[model samples]
Target: MDVLDFDLSDREFWAKPMVERRDAFDRLRARDTPAFFAEPVVDFAPQGPGYYALVKHADILEASRNPEVFSSGSGGATNIIDMPGEFAEYFGSMINMDDPRHARLRRIVSRAFTPKMIKQFEADVNTAAAKIVDDLLDAGPGCDFVAQVAARLPLKIICDMMGIAERDYQFVYDRSNVILGGFDPEYTGGDVSQVVPRLLNAGAELQQLVQDLASYRAEHPTNDLTSSLVNANIDGERLTLQELGSFFILLVVAGNETTRNAISYGLRLLTNNPDQRALWLEDIEGRAPGAVEEIVRLGSPVNFMRRKVTRDFEMNGHLYREEEKVVMFYWAANRDRSVFEDPDRFDITRSPNPHVGFGGPGPHFCLGAHLARREITVMFRELLRRVPGIEGGKPDRLYSSFINGIKRLECTF
Candidate 1:
């Protein structure tokens, strides 16, 4: 048997076009149940353990569903070596937890997004969508869609929800961009050695800002989600100060990054597949939902998540021992030939699209999924209605393996 060294964390590997990466994963999946690889050491982080890249749809789903065997709490989700205890604890959200701890954090956080909050958020999303379209209209044609359009609605909505001031929106936006895409020169710049330190610094800045906001909210409560979070408790349980910081970091990075990338990809994908774009434009109301799902499926932002095996397990006659790291390649699973018919085709009406664009079938499934979907649907509907002639040029992609992001995408209307 030939050993395929598949490194999920390799930046250069991820920089390859989606078609190329998909083909590589397909070949790996055929050969190895879970292909073993020496995990790429990111920045100066020491290589901790070699991992098996979970390439198959079923295997990724199995790991996600059975958190007991594939536990996130055992370590942080990043494929890199261990972070300092304090930093790891402060950065890992409920996504990096299991069982009672995960349940506890999730329950408390759920209170922040009550029905009333969600209803208000939907209304806000619609308003933001309209404003975004209006801005595009005013700016005329040939703008970087990622900057002028796709990135706006979600970031604005998240900032508004968190009660961040308009001035701070840019601050949060810059830091979030750096936090996720710091490895990319478009965001970080300068020496490669400075990237990780700069990312850490940006993270620290975000944590401090959130902490200050949380502190103020705790004292002078308001209707914002930040206030709700600061004051929220469920079953006599509440998030500790550190937990709040971690959750805020997760929300800032995950909330803004995923939706923006999805929207950016949606435009690019639609541009590439005009037939499907026309299909969506014909019935915006009926097709928007499916289109959003398909966009997310194809985008597959947050490429992979790592889990530490707690006990020995067997899948496809391959043994996974305790203490082993397994990187569930969500990107690969999303394109699994066994799952979606015509997996590569970006169809607007892809029904029964069970894409794990959001962390497969698991307890740690994206909390802001409903809101993200709403934002995408509303934004695209507005765009298609107002700027039906909008066409996307080639995208300058983000240079990280973890996030499938378009840093800049030029478009003309």
Candidate 2:
């Protein structure tokens, strides 16, 4: 078979059609190759030792399940090339740590998402969904669904959770888009250095905001999650100011971005497959749960996550050396033919849909996963109820290999 370029970080490669990319992954999986070399420098990082692309479902599952072997804490979870010391720690959040540290951080964060907390958030979620649908109705006929509808619910829910003022919603949203979509022309364009400065600046701005709020929360706590995070402690295990700032950034980006993209793609997927749309509309409440999973499977919002090999290990007849990077292609794994029969087909009623859209089976599986599903379900249910005829047009996608984001998508009812 001809060589397939597994350099997922390449912007041009990401810009290619989705079908072409999936076809390339299919060829790689068919080879039964344990891993393939990835370019060290793709977007803007300095040259370094390359990583391996983990394409198959089984391999990704193995890697994710064995976090000690394929460690996310060793270098950084975000990229194949290890970021600088402070930056890596800040961006990684709990995602980049192992053992006691990871366990401790997760416990503190989990406190914020306890059954009581989630139950309370449900009322807020419903209100947000209603407001979004109402605003879409006011706008009438057509609008940029990504901005007007898909983006609003998650952004509002997260901001409200943090007790942020309504006035600063756009400010937080803009910075998040910049941080996640810096490569896209709409957010940042030109040289790599230019992009880096903007990215750092965005991170700094968010840090300042979170730091200020956290300080206030410490003095006078509230019922919101920001206060919980600020005052969160478990047996003297508490997040330091820097850790709090980083976790805030993760919440803004991951909390808002993942669900936003999923909702955006849900509309697009349903638009493309009217039969499924009808299938959903026929019994909106009944189909929503499974339909949400199918949309997540197809969208695969966080395209891939990177892990570092701490020690040499063998898997699927290939040996991974110590300190080497192994990138789990979650997007590719979600479509594994072995995992999902006729994986390309958009079947809303896909039973046993074990897609790793929320990362593979691991300790680091997305914490906001339950919240995300509720947001998607509530928002789509609102859409089907209020604006059943809404149809999504072509998407203007984000120019990033990491996030499968929709920068803008027009929808008409």
For lDDT, the strongest prediction is 2
lDDT string for model 1 (198-296, tens) is: 777787888888889899999999988788887886667766777887888788888898999999999888888989988988899999889999999
Error of 1 at 23 (Å): 1.6
Number of clashing pairs per prediction, in order:
0, 0
lDDT of 2 at 188: 75
Error of 2 at 332 (Å): 0.4
Candidate 1 off by > 4 Å: 1-6, 114-116
**lDDT per residue as tens, model 2, 294-340:** 99999999988889898999988899999888899999999999989
TM-score of each model, paired residue for residue = 0.95, 0.96
